[model samples]
Target: MSKSPIHPVSSLDRQSELENSPAQLISLDRVSFGYSHKRLVLQDLDLEIKQGEFLTLLGPSGCGKSTILNLIAGFYKPLLGRVTHGGEDIKGPSARRGVVFQSNALFDWMTVEQNVGFGFRFQAVSKHERKKRVETIIALVGLRGNERKYPYQLSGGMRQRVAVARSMVVQPEILLMDEPFAAVDVQTREGLQEELLKLHEQVSGAILFVTHSIEEAVFLSDRIVILDRNLGGIAHDIKIHLPEPRYTAMNRVSDAFNQYRTDLYLKMKAIE
Candidate 1:
């Protein structure tokens, strides 16, 4: 068990950043948003995702977990506050901020290689470089032999691999995932979780994940942020104390793992 290079931010420091211009990979300053003017799903939400950090947002239904991800991705704008990446305002979606949603979002007509290289095709990358890049990403996600297969031909897990490979091929600075493994079976979900940890070690970016599962949150995140639905703000911020090289064989069944899960479960229950 080795110590991982991840830290949880102090509440005081986090509060101070909203007012000061800090060095952050992504920053949300006093952000507030809702569909209609009558109700605000999130109010005055402040968060900072540092480089190379793995942060997860956990909350009950309708707590605006996905809303925060969308705001950072620039799919939706904040009504009152600001969302920025690298100290610049996020006006719209860009390839630099990659997103992976629950649905695979793969085109049924495109093969794995085509799906992975789609982003590069729009850029000035040559055909040879695009193919090389796609091959590398496919291998990274364990989809080497299935490059010729279409979305309908592969299983749920395989389709998700294609989605991940597609997003990663662009070489984004930040990766945002929303319940990416929620559709798979328990065994497959655990397998994907382990694969994701391995991928995180290889990739160089900050990850902001949204999930409703307590065990999933504890297993993957360096820091977990719990949101209270009624208050529309963060209720608890916890730093996971477990060591690195997380695996289902040893780390998942250890005493420390169970303790973190127990603590996070109680926190979620208390918020409800």
Candidate 2:
């Protein structure tokens, strides 16, 4: 049997090709992270996410994908490497980097609008401005009438939307999501995916989404990053040059989609 010609792109070459392009938004350069100087969760990683790009980090548990997210979110300090946002070193969390945690981090005591508007309560925004912000995000996340509703009043998916809305109300420069849809049911998850795509299209902010599901990664990302546990570094970084607004072919189940998913699955398994 003869082997088909593999794509002639090297990982580093692919990375350089992306970096040398005009749209690259964020870059992780020689990033090494650990609790101590020796104990490393992530070892010398370099990744570049383009502007308005939806990039998903896919790997198994303990593969340090979440650790990378934490580093990007400024929740954890990297012992050796630095995180840069648009060419500046990220010293700490900024409103520019919006964060969405796994659990619905909504304010139980606050209504949907209040929760979304809460960021402005301390800021200089006036009462009318706050209401406008809340209203804008409420509509964006499809939670219009639910503004008066509390966290308990909404479904799990709705709660997550509130979380998203709260994060988006401030209109950060980038969005960092850590398995945001993992807790929802399949149907709800699908809907949330669609909602996220719409939001991404409208907002056009760079997104770094972390998920274990290859399908979700394939469905949502402009590119996918797979980290291997052994080195706590990237195993595979694949560019998905599929056409814009992916949800239209969400269920296309094409040779390209399946091939991408299978390759991601295999890389994850190999890491294990």
Candidate 3:
């Protein structure tokens, strides 16, 4: 697989290629994990996240959606099998895999500029390059003027943007988001979802997002995997076929979108 840069393209053009992509950036092979050995949260899970594809995990609570994210993030190890990245074992957290939590996790003491650029401090990048990258990502996330403001001064959406910018500034190969937009208002969450799709287009990295909203999963995902309760593993792995330019409001009301929503909603309700 070539590690070439992804040029900016329309969502319509990108969708076909993303679906056809053969590169597997992350793989979970026969993975089984439990916080306690008495009951496994995820069992015998085999999954693959392709490079540059946006894959969302959807399920009811305690279905191990976040547990799978944590395993890929290397926050926890699978007790029975292994999680691999680029064909190697993922022993621990690496800068190659970025994470965004439900909370923004920004430093209230640090300005937006400082927080976004913080990752560079441990890296070997020069001061000039660090500033350049930070400014570019901040602008990409639509936070150009609020560089000096602290997280306390920003709205929930804006602070989440900063968290996204912070994770994205380092250019991780795959971003693991554990319901990063779940805390915001409905209107703000919709806006953030649009912006996130735009960012994914520009950045061209794989995104593994965990969300409960079937609409959100349908809107943002190229594919969605639903986990079953009681460690039943993946119940349904569906390919989303919504019309391109998926960020628009029209796609939300389209027949294809609603059908997918209805199907997924029924599947989820059945799980509960």
Candidate 4:
């Protein structure tokens, strides 16, 4: 059988591409963090997220994946090293970096449009501008007719869509997603994944996604980083090279797909 047309660029080529690409949006250099200094959750970590890159963190639970996200989000300051955005220290969360959790995190009392436009209202943006932004994002996320529906009235997938619209409506520079599709059923998860890819194309902002599913990582990531549970550091950094319009079902079962999955599975298992 022919190899899947998806081909990963050579390491040298990747390095050149990165060097020529946009500057890093987020960087973690020699970082260490933990609830108590005695037990470091992440140690000597160094990472860079370039603009328009889809980077995924994959590891066993409790390997400090979420901790890394928290650090980048500025929820926790690093015990050592620095977390920087655009070469300056990350002081705290900002609209420049929007976050989406596994839970939809939508306001129950607000309608879909209300929830999406919440940020603008708080900033006292003009009413017309808020409505235009909210409506554009609603249509982008495929939630047009349900603008007035409350969170409780929507399905799990629909609620998640609302959450995404809320984040993107502000045009953030980076999106942080923590297992945002974990709660949905298999079919729903697949659909959300496709939707997210479409949304990424429209926004073109950097993404940092955390997930335990190897399949999920393979499907959505442009680059996958595996954390070593024992050492609390990076175990593997793998780049995905897949054809454009990556959703064809055949791509999931292609030789290249299985190879990527098998390679990651073995690496993760060895860590265990």
Clashes per candidate, residues 3 or more apart or on different chains: 0, 0, 0, 0
Model 2 spans > 4 angstroms off: 1-23, 122-129, 249-252
- Per residue, candidate 1 scores C-alpha lDDT tens digits across 23-124 of 478899999898976698989999888776679999999999999999999999999889999899999999999999899899899988889898997788
Top-lDDT candidate index:
3
lDDT by residue for model 2 over 59-106, one digit each (tens)? 878778888888888888777767888888888888888999889788
lDDT of 4 by residue, 37-115 (tens): 9988888999999876789999988999899888888889999999998899999888888899899899999999899
Candidates in order, TM-scores: namely: 0.90, 0.87, 0.94, 0.91
Worst 10 residues of 4 by lDDT: 1-10
Q: Pick out the ten consecutive residues of candidate 2 with the lowest summed lDDT.
A: 1-10
TM-score-best of 2 and 3? 3
lDDT of each: 0.83, 0.79, 0.89, 0.85
Question: Using lDDT as the measure, what is the rank order of every candidate, best first?
Answer: 3, 4, 1, 2
**Is candidate 1 or 3 superior in TM-score?**
3
